[model samples]
Each structure stands twice: as C-alpha cells, then as structure tokens.
Target: MKSFITGASGYLGQRLAIKLAENGEKVHALIRNPKAVKTLEHPNIKFFFGDVLDNISIKTAMEGCETVFHVAALARVWTKNSDDFYKINVGGTSNVIRISQELNVSKFILTSSTGTIGPSLNLPNNEETPRWSSFNNDYEISKSLADTELLKHAANGFPGLIVMPSRIFGPGIASPSSGVNRIIIGFIKKGFAVIPKQSGVIGNYGFIEDIINGHILARDKGAIGEKYILGGENKTLGELFEAIKNRVNKNGLVLKIPVWPLSYYSLFSQFLADRFGIEPRITPDLVKRLGQNSAFDCSKAISQLGYRITPFEETIETTIRFLSQSEDR
Candidate 1:
C-alpha cells in the first residue's frame, strides 16, 4: 500500500519513510524544503514539495495514499514566531484529518508527544493521564492543543489514532529532538552539570527503531479513536548524566541547583529574548517542566499493539555512535 507522510523531512518522518520504502511500499514524503528532495533518495520513495499549512498541498500529496502519518510540527521550545505553532500544529492537523476522512484512508496516525502527559511528581503518567496545566514551552502547548483536536475529531468518527512518543533518540536526520544527543555529548565532553535532582522532572525515552516499530504496530492493530503512548525507559537528569558518564568512561559530578534560582535565571533569559529577539536557552516554562516528573507507562501500547521497548542504555550507545560519525563527516 502507498503511504503519505507529513514532516517526512523531519527525523521521525524521514526514518519512517525510509523504512517503508525499504519494505517495498510506495511512499510519498511531503516536504516543506525543496532541497530535501535530493537527500531523500530511494527507489520507492517520492518527494512531494508541500507544506501542511497549505490545504492544496495536503490534498495533492495524500491523494490515493492508504495510510497517512501526520508527523510534521514546529518542534522547538521557542521560536521568534510563536503563532506558527498553532497555525501548523493545530490548523495543519485539522486539514489532514478532514482530508483523510474525505478520502477514507485505511489508517490515519497522528504523531503526538508525551509532553502533553504530565508534570506528575510521584505517579507515572499513562494514556489515561489528564491534561497538564503546565507546559515546557510553546511547542508543548500547541502540540497538546493539536492532540486534543485529534481526539475530539476521533470521537466524532474521524478515522485516526494518536501515537504519543516520549523522548525519542537514535540516528538519522539532525532534527529537533536530536537535541538530546547534544546534551549527551556535552556531558561526555564537559565534566558534569548542576540541576535539581530532587525535583520530579524526568522523562521516558525510547530508541528510534523501536519508536518506528511502535508506530507501525499502532497503524496495524490500534483501535480507532484511541491514543497510544510509545515509550520505554523513565529516567531522571541525574540518572541520565550517570548513564552518559558510564558510557563515555567518566566519573563526573552532578551539582544540584535550587529550583528558585533556575526560575530566576529563566526570567533573565526571557528578557534577552524579548528585547533582542534572542531565543532564550532557558525559559521559565522549560525550568518548570524540567522540575516535574515525566515518568510514563506504555502498558496500553504494549498490550494492544505488541510494542517492545529497547533499553535506554542500548539507545544511548547507538545515539552517541551516530552523533560521533556525523561530527566526523
């Protein structure tokens, strides 16, 4: 069957498209960047230059495609243009869902983020987790709203399923989520960091291949209108630093910073951003988010879609290797 994917130029979409093509499926990759056309070379893959923001482009690329993976979104924590997040994440999703329903595609998978799940301090979040009052940044807020839109539409007979992935890591395409690799490298290169270890802020992580597998499984077996979280290991910043230190052969230090200090720093960072158009390296939203526990349970995905999560240690090695090689190039 032919598949159409939005954000095919992105890390997840790129990996998904390549996998589909290698499996001998016809894949149409909707890309906003024209230069990406040459990079996505594959026998079974076709590049369609289009933006999800454009209704005509969506209709054109999705025509005759049996499966649609809406993977594109404004992924950064902050951008100079904030409204683009709503326009692309929410508006774009709405258009895709409408077109998919109109075309009656066999499956429509809306890629959502686990960022919508929680700032839960003690309890681990799951698919049943309630909406969060706090967000990491604009990206999370827009994505949360977009996810809501998908669920609302699904309740009204939209043939769509939401696949929420948590802290996905692996090789291929230096996309937005690949920032985790930089964080890893920094820990390896520099000695360590100062953070509030006691703060409940943490996350569940999964490798790219396993995440791709999760999406495929969800498409094949997921119940319509359901949201499935594709996640694996839950880890805190201190734990993550230790893992990196071990992987890179180092015994580093993790200095614990108070939450109030970080919040104060974020305020100064935001000031620079607003006055000089400089994107803040730290934001109050990010500090607040990083202070919350992001542990999640993917039992529903595991039981329903037969999802298998690769251990986080294994993924760290894979990611380090990829980043190292890319830097060498």
Candidate 2:
C-alpha cells in the first residue's frame, strides 16, 4: 500500500513509518520540520515539510496515496498556547477528512485517544463510554471534539476509522524524547528516596510495536465509523513505577502525595509560561488525569482487530536498553 501519514515524525508516527518502510511499502510523511523529516532514512520513505493548517501541504502530501493515516495532532496536556490545540486537533482533522474524501481513499485511519472516553475511577472505560462534560485538558477536549466530528461525517457516509491508543511506551527510536520513556528513565536515574505514588488511577500503557500492528489490523478489519482502543496492561502509577524499578533491579521509595500540590505547581508553572515563555512541566489537567483511572478495556480491539499487546515488564526492559544506548550517542 502507498501510505500517507501525518505527524510522521512523532513518536508513534515515526515508528509506524519506519515499520512500513522496512516492509518495502512506499510512505509519504507530512512533517513541519525539514530537519525531522530527514530522519526517515528508508529509500521508500518520502516527506513533505508543512503544517496541517495548510490544506495545500496536506493535499500535496496525500496525493496518490491509497491509505491515509491521519496521525498529526497537537498532543500536549499543558501548553503555553491552548488555541493551537483546537486548531491542530480539530481543524487539522477536518482537513484530512476532506482531502481523503476528495481523493476517495480506501482507508482513513484517525489516531485519537482513549481520553475521549472521558475519565473514570472504578470501571475501565471503553470505546462506547459516554463522554463527560469535564475534560482532562485542552488537548483532550480538542481530540474528543475532532473524533466526534469525524464520526459525525462517518454517520453521513464518511469512510474513516478511529483508533485510540493508550499511553504508548516501548523502544522507540526517539525513546529518549518520548514521554513514557522519560518517566521510566527519570524514575530510575533520579534515585529519589521516594516516587509519587498514585493508586487511584489505573493507566493502560501499550507497547509501541503492538500499537503499530493494531493500526494495520484496524485498517483491514475495523468497522467503518467505529472506534477501537489499543490498550495494554492496566496498572496504577505506583504499580507502574514498581515495575520499572524492578526492571532496573533497584529499590526506591514509592511516595504517595496529595494532588493538591501538583495542582498548585501547575498554576505556578502556567504563570512562568505566560510571562517568560517557559512551558509548564506540570499542569492541573495532567495531575487530574494522573489521579483518575486512565484505564480502558481493549477487548474491542482485541476481538475485532485481533490485537495483542506486549507485557509491561518486557516493554520497560526494552526502553531501558534503548535509553542506555542513546546516552552514548
């Protein structure tokens, strides 16, 4: 398949593109930075440098593509600029749907988030979970809105499938820069006497390879206009950190702290961000998510798309090895 992917330089998108290229498929990736685009080294991989806001750029990149993977989005829990989230997530998604329809592409896969199912503390959320009015952050709100829009069009005969992956982590080529990787590395490397222990929330973090494979299955078997969540092992923050610590063969304290402090830090960080252009490392939204059950039932993906996920311990070990090697480079 001649595939066209947006956000091809991102953590998931880059891995998806490389997998396709390695399999001898022609791939065209839309990346805003020419420098990042240069990293896709496969002979079958090509790139276009432009923002999703520019229809001309998307059109140019998507031309002659049989399958369209609309992976681009402004993925941030906290941001100095919130408007970009709406623009990139909602507006950019609209452009991709419009162009894919114009071209009559066979498959248009949308990479959404399990956050669209909204937050839960007891039961695991699923694709059919009703959305709560309260969202985790601007990014969640924007994606939920965009996913709604795409499904609305699907109801009106839009041929698109939405795939939501929860908390991806694995040996990404950009492992050092990936969010989950940072958390794993920081927890081990920092050697803190104790780490924040969050028992309230359950997170379903999947391996990157399984997520990529899930995408292919979704492309082949997913029902039109339906959403499938490719999630992995569900565990609390404390369990997650414990798994990492054990994988690293180290013993550290898992400290349980109140969310109030994280909330306060978010406000302070936002102040610095607003005045000095410093990005907030912690935000109220992030804390809220961390304190909620970000867990999901991927049975839909598993049963419908035949998806399988790697174990958490195995993924952590791979991440550690990749990060250790990256330090040399």
Candidate 3:
C-alpha cells in the first residue's frame, strides 16, 4: 500500500510514517522544512517538501497514494497572528479533504485534539459529548472547525475518520506536543517543578504508541464519519506528577502554585510576547484550559476498534528509561 501523510515530520506523524514504512508500505511524507528530510530517512519512505496551503504541493506529494493521513495543523497555544490557526487548521483540512476526494483516496484520517470535545462536567467527555461551553483559545476553535469540515465531507460519502488524542506522551520526537514526556524528564532530572494547585482538574493521558496504533485501527475498522478518542488513564495534575516522581524514585519538590498567580504570570508573559515577540512559556488561554477537567472516555474506541492502552505505570517507566538513556548520551 502507498500512503501519503501530511505533517510527517511532527511527533506523531513522523513515528506513524516510520511504523508504516517498517511494515513494508510505501510512505509519501509531506514536509515543509528541507532539514526535516534527514529525520524521515527510511527505505520505503519518500519525502516531499511542501506546505498544506499550496494545492499543487499537496497534490504533488499525495499523488498515487491509496491512503491519506492529514496530520498537519497549527497546534500552538498562541501565535502572533491568530488568523493563522484558522488558515492552517480549518482551511488546510478542507483542502486536504477536497484533494483526497479528487484522487479517490481510500482513507482520509485526521488527527484532532480532544480539547474540541470541551471540558468534562459530571462525566468524562466522549466522541458524542455535546460541548457545553465556548473554546478557550484559537487552537481549540480552529480544530473544532476542522472537525466540522471533515464531518461535512464524510456526510457526503467521503471516506474520512477523525482521531482525537489526549495529552499524548511516549518515547518519540521531543516536540512541544510531547508535554507529558517532558514533564517526566523534568521531574527526574531537576528534582523540582511547579504544578497548579487545582487538585480536581483532571486530564486524560494517552500513550503515543497506543494512540498511533489507534490511528491504524481507525483506518481499518472505524465507521465512516465517526470520531474516536484515542486516550488512556485519566488523572489529576498532582496525581500525574506523583506517578512520575514515584516511578523515577526521585523525591521531587512539587510546588502547588495557586491559579490566580499563574494567571497573572501568564498575562505578563502574553504582554511580553505581544511587545517583544518573545514566546511565552505559558499563555492565559493555556492557564484557563489547565484549570478545567479535560478527562475523556475511550470505551467507544476500545469496543469498536479493539484499542488497548498500556498500564500507566508501565508507560511511565518505559518513557523514563528512554529519557535516561538520551540524557546520558
């Protein structure tokens, strides 16, 4: 099988391409940066330098491929131009879906965030959950729009599946998206970190390998126009950090920071970002999001797609081992 993948250089996309190539599939990976070509060097993989906005680029990269994995999107919390989120996430997704239909691609899989489902209230949010509130940032809003775009195409008989992953972490590319892995490493290496004091705020953490496999399962067994959440255990921030600390045998000092002060800090960070063009470590929108409960239920994916999640402790140990070896080198 010949598969075309956008955002092939990203944390998930890069590993997905490698896995497919290892499985004897011809992988056509679209990459915007020429330098990223080195990262995707595989016998069965070919790289194309292109942007998602350019139809010619996408067409050239996607030609003669039976399956399409549209993973490209603007996922940052804040950007100088907020319009960029809509352009890349929503507009780019529309372009890919249209082109996939034109080329008669058998499967079009989209990687969306579970944030589009909104925060959990009385129960953990699932694919069918109705969003009760407005989005906190442009990234969430744009991704929701992208999900809507895919649903429209799928409703019209286009073959498309959406996978929403939650707080993905594992040994893979050290991109911004790998927040869980980074936190583990930080706790192990630094022995100290500041965490929010919101003990009730929960988030579903998904292992990268499980989520990647879930993507493949969605392609093979998922129903048309259906959305599947690829997630693992749901735990609060404190519990998550405690797991990492306990696994690493590190007596880390976790300062439970008040939300109000963190909000003020992020506000100042945003001001600096707006004025001096310095990238803020955290933004106000991110602070607001972290304060909410983002837990999810993946039983739909488990029952329908035969999805399975690794034990939380096992995944953390494996991730810590990988990071330890990397640190030594």
Candidate 4:
C-alpha cells in the first residue's frame, strides 16, 4: 500500500508515517519546510514539499497513493487573524477532500479533534452528540467547520472516515513542542507550581500509538461517512498533574486561582506574546476552555474499530521517561 500523509512532520503524523512504514506500507509525506525533509528520511518513506492550500501541490503529493491521511491544520488557541486559521484548517481540508475524490483514493482518513464536539453536559460525548455553539476558539471553530464539510462530502459519496482524538499525551518521534508537551515539561522543570482552580474540565487523554492504531483500524473497518471517537480515559487537570508528579517523584505546589483573573492574565500575556512574535504560555481562550469539561466516549470506535487505549497513568509515565532521556542527552 502507498500512503500519503499531510503534516508528516507533526507529532501524530510523523509517528503514523513511521508506523505505516514499519507495517510494510510505502509512505509519502507532504511537508512545507525544507528542513522537515531531513526528519522524515527513512528507507520506505519519501518527502514531497507542498502546501495544502495549493491544489496542485496536494495533487502532486497524493499521486499513486491508495490512502491519504489529512492531518494538517492550524492548531492554535490565540490567533490575531481568523482568516489564517480558516484558510489552513477549513479551506485546506476542503482541498484535501476534493483531491482525494478526484484521485479516486480508496481511503481518506481525517485526523479531527474532540474539540469539534465541545463539552458534554448530560452524558459522555459520542459521535452522535450534537455540537455546541460555544466552541471556545478559532482553532475549534475551524475544525468543526472542516468536519461538517467532510461529512457533507461523504454524504455526496466521498469515501472518508473521521477519527476524533482527545488530548494526545504520548512522546513523539520528534521533540515536544505542543501545548500538552509544554505542560509536561513545565511540571518537570517545576514551573507549574500553581494549579488553577477552574480546571474541573475532564480532558480525555490518549497515547499517540493507540491513536495511530485506531486510525489504521478505522481505515480498515470504518464505514464511509462515519465518524469515530478514539478517546482514552478522562481525568481532571489536577488528577493529571498528580499522576505526573508521582511519576517524576516530585511535589509541586498547587494553588486554585479563579477563572476570571486568570483569563485577564492570559489576555495580557497573549498581547505581550503577540507583540514579541512569540506563542503565549497561556491564552484567554485556553483558560476559558480549561473551565469546561471535555470528556468523550469511544464505545463506537471500540466496538467497530477494535480500538483500545492505554491507561492514562501509563501514558504519563512513558512521556516523562521519554522527556527525561531527551533532557539527559
């Protein structure tokens, strides 16, 4: 099998590509940066430089591939320009769908997010749960729009499957650079002494390997136009931090600050970060999102795709070990 993966240099995409290669599939990765090409160098993997916005680029990279994994997106909480977010997340997704249909690719897998579903009030969120209008940030909005568009295309006879992963917590093949990774690193470095009070939100955490396995199973058994939630066990922020603290054998101070004050602080921090052209350590949107529960249920994926997730504690230990080794090096 020949597989094409967008965002191949990303945490999830890179791991998925390597796993596919290990499974005896030829992998072609679409990368935007020349420097990223070196990261994907493997015997069964080839890199193609392209942007998802350019149809020609996507088409060229997708040529002769039986499966296409659309994993690229503008994942950010605070962006001054919503246009960039929409252009990359929604518009880019549309292009991928169109090209996959035009190329007659047998399977097109979308690496969507549980953010599209938002917080569940009465019950655990399933794929059939109705999306809430209160999606916090531009990133979530764009992903929701993209997921809606993909569903529309699927209804029109496009062969597509969506895999919605919760908070991904396992170590990546490359270095850690995402929000989750930052939290882990901060805790390890004793930077996260104060635990915010408004963090009652239960985030579902999944290991990257389990998520990739879920994607592969979805490709093999998922019905066209169907969506699956490949979520792991859900836990609160405090519980998560405690787990990490136990694993690292350290006791970090925990303070519970109200959401309103933190939100204001996040806004100021974001403003400063934007002025300096740096990503903020915290954003207002993120602060607000942390106050809402983001739990999900993956029973459908479990029954249909045979999806199994590692325990959250186990994933945390593995991530800390990987980070410790990298730090030692």
Candidate 5:
C-alpha cells in the first residue's frame, strides 16, 4: 500500500507517516520547502516539494498513492492576512480533493477541526451538529469552508472521510513551537497561571497520538462522505490550568475576567499585533471562542473506529514530559 500525506512535516502528519511506514506502507510526504525534505527522510518514505495552491504539484504528488491524508492547513488564532488563511485552508483543500479524484485514490482522509462544530454549551456535539453561525476565528471559518468543499467533493463520488479533532496536545516531530506546543511551553514557564475570566468555557482536548490513530481508523473503516468527531475529554480552562499546575508543581492564580472586558482587550491586542505584523497574543475571536463551551461527542468514532483516548491527566503528563525533555535539549 502507498500513502501520500500533505503537511507530512507537521506534528500529526509526521507521526502518521512514521506509523504507516512502520506498518509496511510506502509513504510520500508533500512539503513546500526544500529545507524540510531532510526531516521526512526514511527508507520507506519519499519527500515531494509541492504547494497545495499549485495544482501541478498536488497532481504530481498524488500519482500512484492509494490513500491521501490531507492534513495541511493554516491553523492560527490570529493572523494579519486573513486572505492567506483562505488561500491555504480553503483553496489548498480544493486542490487536494481535485487531485485525489484525478488519481483515483482509494481513500481520502481530511484533517478537519472540531472548531467548525461550534460551541456545545447546551449539549455535547455529535457529527450531526450543524455549523454554528458564530465562527470562533478566521481559522475556524476557513476550515469549515474547506470541510464543506471536501464533503461536497465526496458527495460527487470522491472517497472522502473527515476526521474532526479537538485541540490536540503532544510532542512534535520536528520541534514543539506551535499549536499545543505553545501552550505546553507557556505552562512550563508559568505563563498561564491566571485563568482568563472565560475559564468556565468548556474545551475538548485529544492527544496527538490519539488523534492520529483516529485518522488512520477513519481511513480504514469510515463511511465515505461522512464526518467523524475525533474528540476526547471536555474540561473547563480552569481545570486544564490546574492539571498543568499540578504536573509542574507550581502554584498560580486564575483570575476570571468578564467576557465584554476580555473582548475589548483582545481587540486591542489584535490591533497591536496586526500593526506590527506579529502574531497576536490575544484576539477578539479567540476571546469569544474561549468564552463558549467547545465540547464534542465522539461516540460514533468510538464505536465505529474503535477509537480510545488516554485520560486527560495522562495526556497532560506526557505533554509536560515531552516539553521538559525538549527544554533540556
């Protein structure tokens, strides 16, 4: 079997590539930068330099691959250029689907985010939940569009299965620099002591390994044209911070701020970040998102895909351990 993965150099993609290779499958990793090629080198793995926005690159990378895992996307809380988010998240996904269809891949697994499912304040969200009118951020909106595009293509006879994962936390293949890595770093450095006032908002979390496992399972047993929520435990931000504090043996205060005040602060932060072309530490979208309950239910995946997740405490321990080792290095 052959597997072609976009964003194979990313945290989840790299792990998936390794797992596929270890299971005796040939893996082709699509990366845009020539410098990133070395990181994906292995006996059973090949690297292809390609941009998802470029059809030629995508088409070339899809040739002879039996399974395609479209994992690459613009994932960020705040960005100066919102157009870049759409280009990479929406346009990139379209290209991947088109190329997969052209090559007749046996299965196409899309790495969608649970962000699109919106806040589950009243109840746990299932795959049947409709997209919320209020998107948390541009990243969420772009992903929702891409997910819709992928599903549309699937309806048109493309073998697509969407795996919607919640906020993933774990060690990275290359380095722990972004995504949950940032949070882990912050926790280790005592940067998140005070729980923002939106602490009551529910957050769904899954370990990277568990999320990758869910993706593989979705590829194998998922029904074509269906979406599966690959989520795990739901806990409040305050609980999460407490877990981190316990793991690090640090005492920190969690100050709760009202939503309105946080929103204004986030807006100011975003303005400053955009003016300087730097990533915002906080954004209005993020503030709004953090104020909502983002819980999700993965019963379908649990039963159909045999998906199981580690306990939240265990996940936190593993993450902290990985971060500690990385810091030592």
Candidate 6:
C-alpha cells in the first residue's frame, strides 16, 4: 500500500517514485535536498529529507511502508576520495537494510548494477555469472560489496532481492550514472564524439521505462535473495552510434582511439583533476572497463518477472527526440 525509496532525486529513483505514486500507492521519497520536492510533487508522493547513511532519517521515512527500493549509490567513474564509494554504496546500503528489517518491510529491492557481473568472459553474462576479473573501478567494487551485503541479509530472513540494470538510457535526469543518455546527447548536440578504437566492445543497453517496469515486476514476483539482470539488446559501441545517426538523420564525427593512448590521456586528465579539482572526462579505470565486453543475458528476468525490452531502434528514436526537446527548452 505504501513504499519508501532512497535517492528519489536521482534519475532512476525519481522516475520510479513517480511511477509508484501514479499507480495509487502512497510513496515516501528520501532526498537530501528539500528543493527536489518540486520535481516529485504528486498527490500520493510525500518528500522525506534524508540520506541513506542516517538511520534515524531512514527509519522515520520508512515507517508504515510495505516496500523499500534502495536505489541510491555513488556511481561516478572517479572520486577524489575512493572511500566515498564504499561509504555510500556499502555503508548506506547496510543502514537501509537494517532499518528495513527493523521496520518489518515486506519487500526490499536493492538496485545493483550489471557492472558487478563483470565483463563477458566467453559469453554474455547471466544472473549466475561470477566476476571473471577483478573490479575495474571503485564504483563496481563498492556496488559488488553492497550486493553481497543485501544477499547476506536476505539469507538471514530479510525480505530482499537485487535488480541489476544494464546501462539504462532514454528520457530521465541526466545523472552521471545515466551515461548512455549522456552519450546520446553528446552525439546529437555536439556532432562529435570519441570512442574506444575497438568499437566492437559489446554492452547491454536498457530503456528507462523497461527498467522501471522491471523493478515493479521484481517487487511483485521476484524471489527473495535472487539477483535479476534487467537488460535489453546486446550491442557494440559502433552499432550504438550508427543507430543514433540513423534516428537523427545527422552524421557525427566519431573518432576511435586505441585503448593504450586513451589510458595515457586519462592519466593526464587525472593529473589535471588532482592539481586543479577539475573532473576528468574519463579515467584509466573507466577506459579499462569500457574495453571489455559489458553485455548481459536477461532471460531470467524475462521469464520470471515478465520483463520486456523495447526494440533498440525505436528506443533510440524516442531518446533522441527527448534529448532534442530538452536542448530546446
């Protein structure tokens, strides 16, 4: 009847909160900034100013809610202090789980990432896929740790499940975690882009609407302690760009660079960041991650949760239109 959501101001969380509210559920949305309430205003949605790290605030907001969606995380490619990743992703997640258990929440969905599944080894990764390599960055490592914590709690009789969504795109807040949407914006607005030389590196791209629906289905039908990969088409970087070009009817200059050279460039970017506090466009760890295959298999979610993926071409066109409209405003 009621739900509590963390990171309600974020791209996915914001959309998820609104979706639940529209579905006639009383939604308590946790956001650190009070100003974000403007965007989330709905008759069924109430704003709770809080952070996931604070037990008192989480407990207060989650009171009387039947479900909790832990959607908050530090998903950036680089942070000045790497500890920030573990602190929020792992620590914040643990706090929420403890509070949820204390409050007797019926369903808990932890929003994990497909990155934790690691790059594809011999095939596209499935829910059972183990990390084939050490984590490429702190974000992945921290999220993986958070997933472990959720599962541990679930095994101990906590009502929790993990939903891992691959690089989500389409209309939503262009947060750092929404990299695919940012890429679409860049190609359409700037008319120029740079990519890894090996453009064939495969990755899974999911539409935002599909991902949101997957979360709802996970809550309704997902098994306790199980992790589901909610994803769409397995596409190469080249194919991704080609789809955008076709949809927009415009050509963008996409220059591909070798990974080694990009690594050197990222080193310089990091140096600039360390010296002047400017955010690096890319980092060495991100480059390494991108060079590997990030594709996934969503058959489990498809079969168990009735998850459906939109056709990639239609999804891209819809995304391009949304981005184009936003730029005009």
The local lDDT score (0 to 100) that residue 18 gets in candidate 3 is: 91
lDDT of each: 0.83, 0.82, 0.90, 0.84, 0.82, 0.91
**Candidate 3 residues 1-329, lDDT tens each?**
99999999999999999989998999999999888878789999998989789999999989999899898988788888989999999999989988998899999999999989989987899999999988899999999999999998899999998999999998887788878887877777788888888866899999999998998898889998999999999998888888887777656688887889988999999999999989999899889888889989999999999999999888888888888787778
Q: Which lDDT tens digits does candidate 6 get at residues 158-206?
A: 9999999999998987689888888878877778778888999998999
lDDT of 5 by residue, 44-125 (tens): 9988887799898787878899999999987777667889999999999988888888788999999998888888858888
Backbone clashes (count) for model 6 = 0
Candidate 4 TM-score over all chains jointly: 0.94
TM-scores for all candidates: the values are 0.93, 0.94, 0.97, 0.94, 0.93, 0.97
Clashes of 5: 3
| Candidate with the larger TM-score of 1 and 3 | 3
Quote the lDDT for 243 in model 5: 81
- RMSD of candidates 1 onward, in order: 1.9, 2.0, 1.2, 1.9, 2.1, 1.2
lDDT of 4 at 72: 90
Residue 266, model 2: Cα distance from true site in angstroms: 2.2
lDDT of 2 by residue, 267-295 (tens): 89878987998988876676766667777
Flag clash pairs in model 1. 200-292, 200-293, 201-291, 201-292
Q: Write the residue-wise lDDT of candidate 1 on 51-132 in tens digits.
A: 8888888888999999999999988887788898999899899988888888899888999988877666567788887865
Clashes per model (N, Cα, C within 3 A)? 4, 0, 0, 0, 3, 0
> Candidate 5 at 100: error in angstroms?
1.3
Better of 2 and 4 by lDDT: 4
Report the lDDT tens digits of candidate 4 across residue range 1-329: 99999999888888899899889899989988888766677899988888899999899999999998998988767666668989999999999999998899999999899988988775788999897758787888899889889989889888998999888867775443255666777777764556677556677888888999998998889999999998789888888877877776565655677777777888889888778766677888777777778889999999998999888777888888997777678
